[model samples]
Target: GAGVSQSPSNKVTEKGKDVELRCDPISGHTALYWYRQSLGQGLEFLIYFQGNSAPDKSGLPSDRFSAERTGGSVSTLTIQRTQQEDSAVYLCASRTSGSGGYTFGSGTRLTVV
Candidate 1:
């Protein structure tokens, strides 16, 4: 993909069900980040990964949320035991580690019903 591409642009899952959102970053970029935006809210960083840098998982809301990067390219965010509060837009952004414009995916709108 020329830019970040996220799977399942919209997902509606029953409460307590787990869901996985995928992200494909731009080719040759080294920095990738995951963020969540609640209803009309600012983005909350979830994780950050840069080539060889320690994965910054500090922003993860709980153990129920986890993500992984493979080959420094694609990533996946998984949410477990979803609650109504879990409903939000999961966004993926990628940029060159040193300097570059961040490209954000359309985002996955997860709604827990």
Candidate 2:
């Protein structure tokens, strides 16, 4: 794809259910990032994956959130035991190792009810 691609533009899950969001970054991009944005809040970093090194999961909100990048191209963010507070727009971005800017996906709008 010419740009980052995220699946299921919108998702509605029950309070206790789990959901998986997918992201496919541009070819050759070495860095991928996941972020969350609450209604009027700024973007909150979630996780980052660069090349083959260990992923930086420091920004994840809780133990229930996890992500992985397979083959350094496709990534998945999984949220367990979804709660109403989890409702937000989850975004994915990718860039080359030395790029100063990132290309972002449209994002997955998760609504926990």
- Highest lDDT scorer: 2
Q: How many residue pairs clash in each candidate?
A: 0, 0
What would the TM-score be for candidate 2 when compared with the true structure? 0.98
> How many backbone clashes can be found in candidate 2?
0
Model 2 per-residue lDDT at 22: 100
For model 2, state the Cα shift of residue 21 in Å: 0.2
| Cα misplacement distance, residue 59 of candidate 2 (Å) | 0.5
Give Cα distance to truth, residue 62, candidate 1, Å. Answer: 0.7
TM-score of each model, paired residue for residue? 0.96, 0.98
Cα error, residue 14 of model 2, in Å, equals 0.2
| lDDT tens digits, residue span 25-105, model 1 | 999889999999999899999999998778899999999999999988899999999999999999999998787678999
Q: Write the per-residue lDDT of candidate 2 for residues 15-110, one digit (tens) a residue.
A: 999999999999999999999999999999999999999999999999999999999899999999999999999999999998599999999999
